[model samples]
Target: MANVSYFEAWGMWFDGRSTPGNDLLGLSMIWWGRFGKILSFVAGAAVIVDLLGPSRLSRYSDRLTGFLARRTFMATAGASFVAAITFLWITDPIGMHRLLQSVLCLTFVTAAGLLVTAVSRALPATHRVIRAASRERVVG
Candidate 1:
C-alpha cells in the first residue's frame, strides 16, 4: 500500500463507497507520522465552520465573505494537492517529494492566511451594515 499509485491513493482518500482499507479515513496507517487522526478531524471541522459561518450573503459584507470562501477553497485544494504529493513521495510512490510539498504548502498557507485576513476585515463592516439595516427596518 505504501507505493500505491496516485489514482489508488485518491480512491482511498475520497471514495466512501470503497472497501474498508480503501477508505480515505483509513489512511491513518500510512501517514500517521505525527499529528494523528484527531488533528485531521479538527482541521476538517475548522474548514467546515469557516464555510458555514452565520454571515448572510444578502449583506454587502457577505460579498466579501463569498470572495474569501472562494479564495480559501482554492488555497485549500492547492494545499491538498501538495500534501498528497508529499505523502506519495514519502511513501516511496515516487521518491522524496518533500521539497515540492514544502513549497506548495508554504504558498497555499500564505494565500489562505491572506484570505482569512480579508474575511476578518470585512466582518466588522458587515456586522455594522446588518445592524443598521435592522434598525432602519424597525424604525419604518
Candidate 2:
C-alpha cells in the first residue's frame, strides 16, 4: 500500500509507451489513444490534488474503507491482480503490458470511488438519527 502521485504511480506501474502517431492499425487506435492520454492526464492531476492540497492520508483511508467497502474493493482488486498477471511472458504482447498496468491503476480509482460512495451512504443515516434526537426549544 504505497501512496503515490496518481500519474507517477500509474505511469510506472503500467509503463506502456504510447505511440500517438502510428496509424498502422487503423482509425480506431488514434481516437482511443488520444482519449487515453486525456484520461491519464486528468487522473494524474487529481492524484496531485489529493496529495498536495490539504488532504490527509487518514482522511483518504476512512473514505477508502467506507466507500470502497467489500464488493467494490474485491472486484477491482481481482481485476488488477488478474491484469497484472496477464503481462507475464507474453510474446509480441501488443503492448499489453502497459494496458494491464493501466487496468491495475484503475483499481485504485475504483477503491477511491467506493470510499466516496460509502461515505455518502453513512452521512444520510447519521444525519437522520441526529435530527431525530433534537428536541423542540422550550423557552422558560
Candidate 3:
C-alpha cells in the first residue's frame, strides 16, 4: 500500500508521531530525519560556542570572535527566530499556521535584504577595479 509522503513522515517523526511504515523508504526517511536532527544540534552548538567566545584551538579565533562579537545581537536574534519557528512548526501550535506563513515570508525578505547588502558592500571595490582596468586598456 502507499504510505505517507516523505515530508509528512519527517514531520511526523519530528513531532513524536508514529513512524512512517515498516518499509525501506520509511526506514530511509527515519534515518535521514535523525541525521537532520543531529546536524541541527551541531549547528546550534556551534552558534552557542561562537556566542560564548572563541575557542583556544582555532588560529583565527580572535578574528572570528571579533566578527561575532560585533554582531552578537543580530546573531542571537536570528538564532532565536529560527528556534521559535522550529518549535512552532514541530509542536503544531494552535492557530499558528498563519503566523508561520508570515514568518516564512519575512524570512525570505530578510534573506534578500542580507544578499543585497552583501552585494552593495562588494560593488564599490569591484566597480573601482573595473574602471581602472578599462582606463588602462584604453590608454595602453
Candidate 4:
C-alpha cells in the first residue's frame, strides 16, 4: 500500500486550487442575497408607513411614490428569483451553470437599481462640489 499522510487519510488536503472568475460572481451573489433582504424589509416598512397618515415616503409631489413602487417590485421579484434558484441548485448542483446564469441576471438588475438610487442620492452633493470649484476658480 502507498504511504498516506494523516491529513490525506482524513481527506483534509490543503490544496490551493481555485475556480477562476467565480470569486467575483460568488461575492456579487452574496451581496445580492443580503441586499435583497434589506430591500424587502424597506418595502415592508414603506407599506406600513404609507398605511399611517401623512407619511413622507409615499409622497407623490416628488415622484418618489412611483419610484419606490417600481424598486420595491423589482427587489421583491429579484429576491424571489434568487431564493428559487438557491433552492433548486441546492437540491441538485448538476445544473449549476444554468442556475448561476439566472442568479447573475437577478443580481445585475438589483445592482443596477441600487446604482441608480445611489447616483440620484449623490446628485446634490456632486452639484454642490462643482459649484464650489467653479466659484473658487472664478474668484481666484
Ranking by TM-score: 1, 4, 3, 2
Task: Report backbone clashes per prediction.
Answer: 1, 5, 0, 0
**Pairs with steric clashes in candidate 2:** 67-114, 67-115, 67-118, 68-114, 68-115
Model 4 earns a TM-score of 0.32
List CA RMSD, all candidates. 13.3, 16.8, 17.2, 17.3
Q: Which stretches of candidate 4 lie over 4 Å from their true place?
A: 1-97
TM-score of 1: 0.34
Best by TM-score: 1
lDDT of 2: 0.52
Q: Across residues 1-140, which tens digit of lDDT does each residue of candidate 4 receive?
A: 23444354334225643222232323533454578799999999988855753423223323643454456656555555665566565645555576676676566656655665665565555555555655675577
TM-score per candidate, chains pooled: 0.34, 0.25, 0.30, 0.32
To one decimal, what is the Cα RMSD in angstroms of model 1 from the true structure? 13.3
Residues 1-140 of candidate 3 have per-residue lDDT tens digits of 33566576667769997664423354554565688799999999988856654233232443445565566557655655665566557546555576766776567556655654564455555555555655675577
lDDT ranking from best to worst?
Answer: 3, 1, 4, 2
At residue 63, candidate 3 shows an lDDT of: 46
Error of 1 at 41 (Å): 21
